[model samples]
Target: MDAAARQAVNLNVLRRHDPAISAIVDTSSHVVVYNFDSATETWKKVGIEGTMFLFRKESLNRYGIFVMNRLSTDNHNEELNSEMEIQVMGDYVIYRTLDDKVVGLWIYEASDRARIAKELEKWVVAARQMGAQCLQQSWIQFDVFSRHLAVFIICALAEDLLQSVDTDRVPSSVSATCMLARFRPDPPVSAHWFLKV
Candidate 1:
């Protein structure tokens, strides 16, 4: 089968699984309608308001990281509200208003886990210095995928830091206990984990 044939078959399968996928794939246009509720006759436009990036994990692993912004509404119509249209883009993601005004620009990429963690640390310190906690909070509200990625990076960085610590340099009494506590990974890392340090 040719490339086009394979894509068609894939699209068919996607549409069969969830017809909403068709709306995203069929359009070359940037505008997307989401959180549609036929019963309430309400819908939201992607990148208009209440938009956030949901990382496609499979796509992130396969093709350098990718994310799509999902628009949400408060409509209580549950049955038809399951479908949401998001425009998945690579690298840079741009947000614009209906009047063609630039609202936001997001630069996302996958990098060495430890390096990213270090960068996040710097950001936290800088935020603290600049009294930008509110700014960070706003960021937290919108970027769900990046928050998950930050958790992973933090955990990796913690593991690396713990491994590099020389037990011989520390007092013998608490060394074993410290090592044991650092290695256990259950709750993963939290957004405020850097704040504790």
Candidate 2:
């Protein structure tokens, strides 16, 4: 074969081995990444281990938000993780865990919160595509592993955001009466009611 033809064949083989899309997935509550840099343009891939913080709803509220770079899971977290957030920060600093080396200093801003949350909406599409291409069957058997995970992340954030209403902490002007009516009808249908003050 000619040199040009041989190189073309090698590139095809490499592409076949590479994934069509990359995904951030949760393999049973543990955040795992199956990123194929070759699938995307070199310039698109930042070539760094990006961080995603998965926090339990209760723990996040109780302890406040934190990123566990140490990758530890005690007996407490294993049992209860129904609601969670696969959170990526708007801006963050990467440093070695104390387990390896001391963490470095960084600056964080309040506005960064809104900027990062915008990324969650994009996960739905990426998750669906990830499930379609040739990937480990264990992940794809559900047809779209990341799709379900995407829903979970969205739901987790929604629930956490509504924690105030869930706990009856609304403004006095707005009675907790609407809060009481929540889900009295299982599987709320498409209906809207106008409140005439």
| Candidate with the greatest lDDT versus the true structure | 1
State how far residue 157 of model 2 sits from its true place (Å). Answer: 57
- As a TM-score, model 2 comes out at 0.18
Per-model CA lDDT versus the true structure: 0.37, 0.32
Q: Candidate 1, which ten residues in sequence have the lowest lDDT sum?
A: 75-84
| Backbone clashes in model 2, listed as residue pairs | none
Per-residue CA lDDT of model 2 for 1-197, tens digit only, reads 99567545534432343322122122111222222233452222122222333222222222111222223431111111212233343343222222332222122443444443343323433444444442454444443444545665665565566665545566766544454344222321321211111
What lDDT tens digits, residue by residue, belong to model 1 across residues 135-176?
A: 575565547646656765776777677568886786777665
Where does candidate 1 stray beyond 4 Å? Answer: 1-145, 173-197
Q: Compare the candidates by TM-score and give the number of the best one.
A: 1
